[model samples]
Target: MELSDIRKEIDTIDEQLLPLFMKRMDCAKKVAEVKKRDGTPVFNPVREQEILDRISAKAGEYGGAARIVYNTIMSESRALQHSLLGAGKDLRQRISAAPKAPRRTTNVACLGGAGSYSHDVLQALYPQAEPSFFSRFSDIFRCVEQRQADLAVIPVENSSAGSVSEVYGLLMQYCFSIIAAKTLGVHHCLASRTGRIADIRCVRSKDIALMQCSQRLATLQLPLSEISSTSAAAELAEKDVGIAAVCSESAAQQHGLKILEPDIQNADNNATRFVVISKEMCIPDDAQKISLCFNVAHTTGSLNSVLSRFAAAGMNLTKIESRPIEGKDFEYDFYLDFTGNVHDPKVLELLCSLEDELPRFHFLGNYCEMK
Candidate 1:
């Protein structure tokens, strides 16, 4: 066919498709009416699979594409049915009962002391809040859980170091909600008791700090050791002339260590994202970021189906991290963050649908993330 003729044929087929899609939805409404009367469930996996099988058999070369299209049509049909039946009542109720704004108070807890990155974030976001520093991540979580603090500001990820797995684990264990988040620019320095870079024989810092400056450390050819925090490593370096620490300039200053190298991280854009978590759930009106944790259904294509729904809703998913579920040999739980407003009907419906469908899921929180 000529190019113009092919374009004309495509337009004609699209014109024919509109009415067929509308009629199909009208039929779906009637089907919903019958199901409501019979007290039948909305989703019917067996019937959907049978229809898919039948359609694929005759589709020939277009078999895979045909299945995808039909699958979407059926998904939309089930969604309509769910709406007609007023599904997701529990989650809706929870949202209605939750506070729209987080409580502003002075009891804020975070990991590390005066010059730690977490401390920096706490100062930025909750300057007026009283700070309680802990040596361990769990200790901070415990403080919040026991109501010793109103909130916790902690680093969840670093741009150069990747996700902080220990923090993720503690977030799940504590079951706290992230009411707000902050991302801060980071610049690392190599500090030691002596201000000479040539005197450094070994380095010590947090694992994340080590990784962030891995490239610079590789050239030094020094043995490395892991400390609990960058600030703590600086403290140790202040006491030993041979050992070095990769930490913030402020940390080295506070610990009385001399800076041997400044800005040692691999990337200039190195930054850390911190979350202000609370025991209470809050959905602020300005919430543009939503965090969710979920375990996918075990059936084949289940994860694809979940992600497809997000794509269909036009949601911009920004982050996804999978962690092994404890006590389960190979099962994983996924932590996802996406830009969305729960007040939007489509967004709310997507969350509700997933809550009802996923094997395990938690709406961690919805809040405005600040830079």
Candidate 2:
């Protein structure tokens, strides 16, 4: 077919698709009503999978790739269906729900201004809470510790990269409790006002952002200068010539910088997990995770014997970190978390056992799952 003819045919098909979409949604509403009447679940993963498979098989008969069209249509259909009724209501019902919103005057602090990873995490995790930004991680920690901020989000570890050693050490030093935690994917970008990569000379960012973008920066072999934070880097690049920032998209937009490259981290699957800290323990109703720290005896198999109690109780440990006992020779403190709640008998038994085994220990706190 001629190009114009193909365009004409596509336009005609799009017009036809509008009515078909309406008709399909009408049918879905009927299905919702029927399910409601029968007290059946609104979302059925098995049925969704079947629908995708059936549509993909049928779409293959047409000109384009089956899976792509199938996924797009299925996602829209599922989303519409969910809106009509509710998505995954049964599972939500089973969950002991938490507070619907952040407490009044719930001030939160993290490492940056407006568009850093800490800011992004604050937005995603809270969505409704008021946030305060800081340049230093220690400042972020101090805000919560001193009651200047009600809570703080501090990065602890990454999947692609290893642990954030600074955050771990700070956690040990601070008297805050790990009230909540979550993981966010890190999507680094090389941003500058100048469009061309060759125009870039000095690169600026936080030490961590610089580390994350080390591979990309190494390729350029430019003089690397460290800034206080990613937001600070973006701020500098906004006013300076021949400079670029390794920062988030939001930061680039805020500072009127352009992204010369996206996802420039050394590891493709880079992610950083953060902990929500508070001076006083305050976990929501739907809390599923607990973090604790304790001092174990300076003896062989002491740590192992304590961990065995959790394993025996069928509790899964998410993390175990050890920090040196300063000024004390050969003594070590351990931080650990497992599946069961602090209120649960199994966990209580383990805690009691740990107290008996270890000289000293403290419960950091239990926290609600973010999502």
On TM-score, the candidate that comes out on top is 1
Backbone-clash count (model 1): 0
Output the lDDT of residue 260, model 2: 91
Candidate 2, residue 253: how far the Cα is off, in Å: 0.7
Query: Cα lDDT for residue 98, model 2?
Result: 29
lDDT by residue for model 2 over 258-354, one digit each (tens)?
8999999999888888888777655565568877788865743446545655655688998898877889987777777766675575555455444
Q: Measured by TM-score, how close is model 2 to the native structure?
A: 0.69
List clash counts for every candidate, in order.
Answer: 0, 0
Candidate 1 per-residue lDDT, tens place, 133-196, comes to 8879999899888999999998999988799999898877666888999999999999998888
* Over 4 Å off, model 2: 1-105
